[model samples]
Target: MSLRKRLIACLDMTDGRVVKGTRFADLVDAGDPVGLCLRYAADGADEIVILDIGATVDARPALLALISRAAAVLDIPLAVGGGVRSYDDAAAFLDAGADKVSINSAALADPALVSRIAQRLGSQSVVVAVDAAAHEGSWRVRSVAGTLETGRDAVAWASEAVERGAGEILLTSIDRDGTRSGYDLQLTRAVADAVRVPVIASGGAGSAADVIAVLREGGASAALLASLLHFGMVRLPELKARLAESGVEVRRPLPAPRPEEVAAWRG
Candidate 1:
């Protein structure tokens, strides 16, 4: 049997506040990152990924103190990114509270960094985030919060990153991000098939069916939920229930409330 598909909650933070926007622009505040992280964990998210979306653009380190605080409260796995540029940075994230550290432009600039981080922290601790957008008829990788295209094929880069010791691929669709249309299934399938490691598909998750399509038809190992979660469009447990009904294996679902409990709660 294959590993169960994971449902991950994504929190994109900027200047200490969680934000969401279409195509990574026109941002609006969502909520407190750490508070939201705790909520998702309690609501049965398989994992929680908190990214400092502005850290790289601002040329500053991740808010380690905030990450540590989030990590301290969570029982599930935590993956963090943004402004992580070196092995030292990666190690620092792990030391602070992240179970895994995500690297974007840094890994693209120096693929060797993946190997070094893996060599020390193990491949399981390394997550290579590939932000891709539609170009012509194929997908190309983007950097710096989807502001610049690298001209590298997203599928090819995912493969290379895995070869360099990236244990997992955090593939996000820049075009579909916050659009709520659906995931870019083609790009997701291409990278998922090209990379041997588990691929977590991000961006464009509007409904449970969208998640089902990405995880099933798209061959993604995990489905990343952002706006759907942050904006209260879909609660994590309810979404997981829908996925379970759709026959996509998830970590677990919230136990059903007893009849008596339900009755008492209804009072």
Candidate 2:
């Protein structure tokens, strides 16, 4: 297996538009989802995770049209989620050009959905998303656009998801999301250690060093980026080069940085 850690771009969507919010609220427009996905794919992002952050609250379905459009342009894998409530919902996403279907609230409501999707579509095609926030000295799982706290221990839920056939865990720290403070290494490491499957650390990532810290010290197999990439804080190639320089294995063919960009990254 490749030891190269993955760098994933996360596009949170609401009403078909890419947007991001601080701690899952006060969302503002970022860009078009399809355009961003295509750009990330071309820029050497290992994968793209498109989440309809409002779907569950709006009582809408997953963004099938957006997924189809993104899949058409993306040569890399696409993982789509949000408002995936049943096995049929998960299957529809896969049929709509999603390489994998991510289940969040639905999985929490009915753990059987994870196993059913894996049994039908294969575990490799299932990604379980855990949006957790620190609560009372421990992390609690939140769902329904992060408005509801299930009181489930984050690490225990991660292990249970894996046992239910989730091939990977997308662990997002609700406390750090969109803050650019840094990833919650304590939360990430706890979940990563609890699960044998790959854990994609999401949420805070203000600098390249934050990502490297998660991969090297937090024990994550991948890092999910949002505000950093969405707001032009750091280019994917520049970030990958920085990681490689720090002894992190990453996919090659990273573009040579322009002198100006290099200076910008350093500055």
Candidate 3:
């Protein structure tokens, strides 16, 4: 059987509110993280990614309480990232019901952290996030919530992270973020080629066709969406229908409700 294309909805949380922005700046409130997760679960999202964008900088807790609430309400898998610096923080997220913990700045600062987490939580439980920007004609990794440039080649870092036992890479194109055009296919394909594990392409997803383009051209195993879903620009059922029609392997959609049957039931 062909591998199914995975669709993930990212909830960028700060101070318990879901926020989104372009290039990691000018964030606007989306909604409550818990409520959004529940809604996405109902919408047939494959998985939910909760990113605590403020935790690391503020030295605050990683929002385990919020994650716990979301987990309790969602049946789909949850992956928590941001401000996850130590083993304890990662463990806390898992304890609070996260299926996976994603590390980026922490891992880049100390690459061995990924190995340590992988050893304890298993490889599949660890995902390394790489926020990359095309700079000086090369893809360079960014850290500290995309505010600080790392001056490191993204593909090289991704390869090293995987070798250190990261089971997945959440590759986000900083340039393409909030653009609603499409993914940076070249950058995504380069990182995907460098890593052995699954690469989730993030940023610049505007529509279902954009999702298809990323999977096909970027060689990504999955795509992460934010603005499109949060703004109601794309409906999950219709997106899945388009993917199916285009011959991409995706989760089968739930059957549509019959209008007459629904009317009789409501009556």
Q: Which candidate is the best by lDDT?
A: 2
- Candidate topping TM-score: 3
Alpha-carbon shift of residue 104 in model 2 (angstroms): 0.8
Rank by TM-score (best first): 3, 1, 2
Error of 2 at 233 (Å): 0.6
Worst 10 residues of 1 by lDDT: 21-30
lDDT of 2 by residue, 1-267 (tens): 367899999888888877852332223423578877877887899999998877854434437877888898898999988888899888888888999988998899999989999998999999999999998888999988688989899999999999999999999999998788899999999998888999999988999999999999989999999878877788899998998899899998656679998788852
Tens-place lDDT digits, model 3, residues 1-267: 677888898988788777853332223423667777767777778899998877754435438778888888887899998888898888988999999999999999999999999999999999999999998777999998888999999999999999999999999999999898899999999988878899999999988888999888899999998888877788777887888888888877667579986888852
Screening candidate 1 with a backbone cut-off below 3 angstroms (N, C-alpha, C), the clashing residue pairs are none
> In candidate 2, how many Å is residue 49 off?
0.7
Q: Which stretches in model 2 have alpha-carbon errors above 4 Å?
A: 20-30, 56-62, 254-267
Model 3 CA lDDT for position 137: 76
Residue pairs with backbone overlap in model 2: none
Model 3: per-residue Cα lDDT at residue 174: 93
- lDDT of each residue in 48-119, candidate 1, tens digit only: 998888785443443788888888999889999888888889888898889999999988888899999999
The reply for model 1, stretches above 4 Å from the true place, is 20-30, 56-62, 254-267
Model 2 has an lDDT value of: 0.87
Give the clash total for candidate 1. Answer: 0
lDDT of each: 0.86, 0.87, 0.86
